[model samples]
Target: MNTAKQRKASLPERGFAWAAAFLLALFLVASLFSLLAVQVMTSAGLHTGTATNDSVLDGQMKIIHNYIGVLADAYGFEAETVRQSVSRDELRDFNLNAAAWWTGVLAEGESRTIPRWYSPAMEQAIRNAVDSAGTGEDPNVILAEITEKIDRTVYPLRESLLTTGLDFVNKRADIPGIVRSLRQVPPLCLVLCILAAGLIALLAAREVFSSLKYYGTALAGAGLVLAAAGIIYAVMQLKAMLSQASANLADEFGTMMHTLFLEAGGAAAVLLLAGFACLFIYRNRFEKHMAPGEEQAA
Candidate 1:
């Protein structure tokens, strides 16, 4: 150890330094919250193209497709056969409507009608086709009857369903707002953190080494707290929220919430590690810069 001692800081100067440190701590805390919020929003609400795979939305979509198939079968139509006839554009429209149904459940106090995918006339015609499918009816005649019925009736019904679904999709996600929020929050957090650090540095210019340990310890403590909270929240969300709900839309919402909570928890853990690292670095090496009693001596 170099037996070197620095002169003490004035009482006013010491108070100002500690005050600046406190402000810095607050800024760091804000930064942590903002970072986690951004992740949660992006994961749950933004619905990026790549994020769609295996997401709650994807799961919800499967449920929707199954529902449509079931509805068609209830009306005596071959659901799989009909679905096979759907074009890419029609399929896209149907998906949008299904997603709309999913979105309503996620919003609190939001009531929306579940779409009836087929008209009564369409159902009746399909039943008629099913009834006349066999029973010694001329083979070509029966086939012709069924084909004509579907071309005139079934395809029209499908187009209407597609139109309805497209309308729902148009209403669901607010793209511009989501993009704006994502962009704004992180930069704001960064600015606050930088300003805080600068304030601390300015106040502690004379005792730079001594103040660093305090800063590191604050970071470590905040990070650990956030990490622990995040872990607990993640566990609770997985157990209580991730399970599929009785309704298809509710199940999709559960998935969305689960993913968001998980991401938030991860962010907290990263913040915690960063804080601990800061504490370790200062405690082990930078603490030596203070000489342990600079302010007291002055």
Candidate 2:
């Protein structure tokens, strides 16, 4: 009983186990956080939130917004011209019936207009764009004009519309939520990492070489997991890129995304290698694998 009591008390003289566990946890989390950040930076739709330089979907979003805006202005002008001949009440009645029918026909997630301005005033001041798209002189010319008008009116709101892109607005609800959650991780992990490192250093000072084997194993496992994950993700990205239909997509954005995945994988690989080395050097308490001065470190 006396001997066991002395051993237990001696264990407190070595708080290195807690220190090792914390440090290991922090390192693994940091690698994961870096990988997630890389993923966000590489995606144009996602990068805006992280302040990553992006050319991906930002330009496209502006073009689409402008294209729709031009059509809206043209439709408004046409309707205003029509209202010049018709009485106000006639326009009101027509608008009410048309809006009711259009709204009734709309399926879930299908929006007739942005901002959904179905008010009487807007209705009277709007041409029936959906009904009159192809009923004009030279449909090709009309399309070209609309496209040009939109190009002229392009306004970029990329940074502000990171999670509000067309894809998400159309019902990728999960994406916005995931991004919001991920954006908070790096800072949280950083705090945890610093805390863990400080505690580990303190414990290490208190009990040198006390928990080397445990730390070594934990680090090695973390590294292996990270490396394996990165390798798998890189392979999957390569396969997906190969399968894409558009050449430009496959070559440009797809390649960029793939590269980002690989970068994550690379980070994971570094962690994995470091873990393996730690484990190898701390295989046993005997310190047989330690370098000349490494035992002092332990």
Candidate 3:
């Protein structure tokens, strides 16, 4: 009669324990994925890699040269002469600076005007061309005209090249607020996961080995799901799914996605290993300490 009453009481506790374990699994997966996302989104190295991609920089320089060609045709200046003024090295330095500035903006939500290094370089090139050609006109007057044209034409192109498409989203949504919420998600999920874990332990207080089994099951379940997802994503070709309007953009997005999945996979592996270790300890060590009948029941 006493054993029957004990079993009856344990039924409710076991039910609660199962529920907590399920919640723990769910929260574990959520926290892991959210943490990976936050890290990828705010990674400076990733941003800089995208910014300094060879194809992207090459494309920007090509457009700039094309604009200079148009200006040369209109103002009777040599296109090559102006193009030669800004060396590839100078353009590379400008991009490096721009990447640093963009990284800061993403992190701090502080805005700064992008420097117009190209404008000065192009303007001086035009002035040199006029002087070399012996145009007999005041170089300053010609410089002013070309400078105005550069402001109207090349400046917009420069802005487009250097931008990471955030401005478009910022205009439509509260990006800073969204980022703040994203930053908070992982820690919030972690706290809830801990609470669930604690609840499971409390519910199974009299059955310590049972709590270990529950924890092992929860962690293993979550790890398996996360790992499978990460592997699937890593193998999938994301570039085809992304907007092909800009090849450079697609490449960068793919790179970021790759990093995210790799981290997820790594985290999942750790969780899976830990879960298995717990289960192994419970089976080998804890079960041996139980009475023959209790061990058989377990």
In TM-score terms, candidate 3 sits at 0.64
For model 1, the run of ten residues with the poorest summed lDDT? 149-158
Q: Is candidate 1 or candidate 3 better by TM-score?
A: 3
- Per-residue accuracy of model 1 over 87-151 as CA lDDT, tens digit each: 43343444455444434432221334654333333345444545554333333342344344323
Instruction: Quote the lDDT for 280 in model 3.
Output: 85
Error of 3 at 218 (Å): 2.0
Ranking by lDDT: 3, 1, 2
lDDT of 3 by residue, 68-141 (tens): 68766666767798877756666666666766766666665545576545557766777888777665656666
- State the lDDT at 288 in candidate 1: 53
Per-candidate count of clashing residue pairs (backbone under 3 Å): 3, 2, 0
Q: Work out the TM-score per prediction.
A: 0.54, 0.41, 0.64
Kindly give the stretch of ten consecutive residues in candidate 2 with the minimal lDDT sum: 1-10
